[model samples]
Target: MMNEIDLTKVDLEKPFMAGLMDGMPGGFFVYRGDETKKIIYANQKLLDIFDCDTWDEFVELTGGTFIGMVYARDRMIVHDYVRRARESGRTSGVTNYRIHTKKGVFKYVQNYANFVNDYVEGGLVYVFIAAARSTHDRLTGLPSMLNFLD
Candidate 1:
């Protein structure tokens, strides 16, 4: 079936994605509507990244819109990628432009996400670790945990 969003239910209501979002390795955020993707839910880790303790402060970051916090150049790409995945009902992944955290300063991170479903309209998801750990050779950025020399 072609999954579609019912905008009426996807407005500024707090999405139904609180619990699952809390478990992601990095952080998670959920915004509603297009004009101002007003953040309805953001996991604690995300709040910690920005030192934000409340949803109201986070929502204001959008100036009121449903776009992600990724770099400007990446928004359209992310949107297109998400739309395609939603249409096919086949899961997809992306190398998202992630605004990351350093010791205290923020940096951009390349991350991945596997979508779950339309928590409202755009869909809720379990975002993965931004910089995944490698267990492989220093020679290559590959998983080597399964095979290594003693």
Candidate 2:
């Protein structure tokens, strides 16, 4: 029989969780699930993705908010999508959008988010972000071979 670990007893700020987040390939972050959507935590990879050298710089660039991290043109659509998904009782979903980095370059990113109720924060969204690579040919707009293998 497998022993089930109790999440309620786990401390998220512990080294194990911190190390895991830091070692992850892509970016990971957590934000409040409120109108402000204030950022609570961000891994180093996330700072790199935003072309920021430190957490302070990242916060300054993004105004410490999730919506601020998104490209202005894509914010409304992304927000609507998340709201709709949550309203439909979905706990997690993926959103493809663009982000205006601190370097002023817009990069397409795929954001995977999980909506959960936290014991301390009430509502929170844990997110993983990665560069969005096209699985289709740009010119012909056809699916690539990698798509078929999946």
Candidate 3:
């Protein structure tokens, strides 16, 4: 039901916002939609999900980029989806992809992304606020094929 949010106006660096992001569930993160897709923020849950022990380690491993965490075969598909969403001016959408974990595991997660236009360095760029959760049965702690299909 939510339509749009002017993320450019939201102070993402505010301590309160960062605190809220930390408490949120799933793997919450924000990244640029530019060619670099630079990751600006990543919550602790995201680090835990990726099996990274610390933020510095995670950044080092992925080179502070989101694409580096994507499974090789899924990069194009995921990138194209983001591109389409941005072009359509869609604020949010659902997506699924395999992510490479720091533990050398590939995890399939259902992801939700919200797009915001941010003006940085006098240029307008896209910022993506994303949340990802395992495509698994919570009770059983097992991969759920049904969830993946959805």
Q: Among these predicted structures, which one has the highest TM-score? A: 2
Residue-level lDDT of model 3, residues 1-150, one tens digit each, is 988867667786887678878887667877776688778778888888778989998897788887876778888988898789778977788777777778888777666676666565321223222435566674796678876677
lDDT of each: 0.54, 0.90, 0.73
Score every model by TM-score: 0.49, 0.81, 0.70
The number of the candidate with the highest lDDT is: 2
Q: For model 1, how does the per-residue alpha-carbon lDDT over 1-150 read when each residue is reduced to its tens digit?
A: 999967566544345445446656776655553345455556777765644566665445534233546546557876787678778885647554434232334344544555555754774554443543333444684446754432
* Backbone-clash count (model 3): 0
Give a tens-digit lDDT track for model 2, residues 46-105: 999999999999999999999999989889999899989988999999988878898988
Query: On a 0 to 100 scale, what is the lDDT of residue 109 in model 1?
Result: 51
Which parts of model 2 have CA positions greater than 4 angstroms off?
1-10, 134-150
What 10-residue stretch in candidate 1 is worst by lDDT? 98-107
Model 3, stretches more than 4 Å misplaced? 1-15, 120-150
| lDDT of model 1 at position 100 | 24
Q: Which residue pairs in model 2 clash with each other?
A: none
Is 2 or 3 the stronger prediction by lDDT? Answer: 2
